[model samples]
Target: MTISAELLPQHVAIIMDGNNRFAKKKHLQKGDGHREGKNVLDPIVEHCRKVGVKALTVYAFSSENWNRPQYEVDLLMKLLEETINEQIPRMIKFQIGLRFIGDRSRLTPELQQLMLQAEQRTATFTEMTLTIAVSYGGMWDIAQTAKTIAQLVKEQKIDVDQVDVDLFAQHVSLGDLPPVDLLIRTGGDYRLSNFLLWQSAYAELYFTETLWPEFTTEELDHAFGVFLGRERRFGKTSEQVQQEKIEN
Candidate 1:
């Protein structure tokens, strides 16, 4: 499917799912599925950059994911560390800016340092931004932002009356980037799963049964094709939107 250039999403966020299921289906260890899922991300990211996506945010690990078996969690952390270390060169080569969102305090110092180093190394890249959400949750993001705002208010940095939706949003994760234009969740999930509550307020959502390990560029194009067919009216009626477009 050829997605129209004009209808391409500026920012796309994905909730990658079903790695374990894919592993079980293949009669392989769960870790193998995660490894495969990790491998698939590079091509998808490259495709997004090639197709002019400005930013791509992926839900890597959620705050709730910590409750999983210790072995699995440890393997995931190890994979993340190794992937970050390995992807830096590719990110530089592709001129992609690497950024991480989520609470960093929970990460080991080594992993945190590696993440920071990766961000610093690719800080000058301008072609596209790849944000990995590890230990992240939509509610946690909101609460953290609110806490920051509360601190500022206590410090007399801002007045209580000054708080508004826009003002409050500025403190949330990815506050500097464009709002999520499309949110894709793989593995047949229909719910947001506390992925990006504040950022996806009006995002066009696409859910697919394809597992993360098998989600390909072609599937991505299909999602974009669907996105192009939808009419984004925001709060306006279709007639009003069409008339405004004509007036413009």
Candidate 2:
């Protein structure tokens, strides 16, 4: 199907799930599913860029994921480091900025340093930004932002009354990027699962039964189509929205 560039999402976020399930279903060795899922992202990233998506943020590891078995957690962390190292060159080639949002204090010193280096190296790229959220959670993101805002207020850098949505927004992750326009989950889950709470406030949601390892660009296209067909009134009435569209 042909997609109209006019209505394409400015930013897209993905909740990649079902790697372990896919592994079990395929009878693959313990951690192969995660590896399979990891490979699926490259094409999707390229597809998003080709379709004019300005940014893509993916849920790589969540704060709660630390509760998983130690071996699995270790494997995931190793994969994340590998992913960053592998993506740096591609990011430069594609002119995409690479970023990370998470509690870095929990990560090893080497990984933290590598993440910072990657962010700084690709800081100026304009083609698109690819954000990987490792050791991240929506509540953690909001709580940290609130803490920062409170500190500023205490320091007299910001007035107590100056705290508002706009002021609070700049302190959150992805604050400088366009708000997430579409959020997709590929594990048949219907919940946000503690990811990108503040940034995806009004994003169109797409859920699919296909596991992360099996999700495809064609599926991504279908999600965009659904987003295009929806009426995102943002609290405006249907009549008012239609009238505004006609005037535009």
Candidate with maximal TM-score: 2
Residues 1-248 of candidate 1 have per-residue lDDT tens digits of 55545569999999999999899999997699999899999999999998899999999999999999999999999999988987899899899999999999999999999999999999999999999999999999999999999999999999999999999879899998989999999999799999999999999999999999999999999999889889999999999989998998
Residue pairs with backbone atoms closer than 3 Å in model 2 (clashes): none
Candidate 1: which stretches are off by over 4 Å?
A: 1-4
TM-score, structure 1 vs. true:
0.97
Each model's backbone clash number: 0, 0
What does candidate 2's lDDT look like per residue over 1-248, in tens digits?
66766689999999999999999999999999999999999999999998889999999999999999999999999999999999999999999999999999999999999999999999999999999999999999999999999999999998999999999899999899999999999988899999999999999999999999999999999999999999999999999999999999
Q: Estimate the TM-score of every prediction.
A: 0.97, 0.98
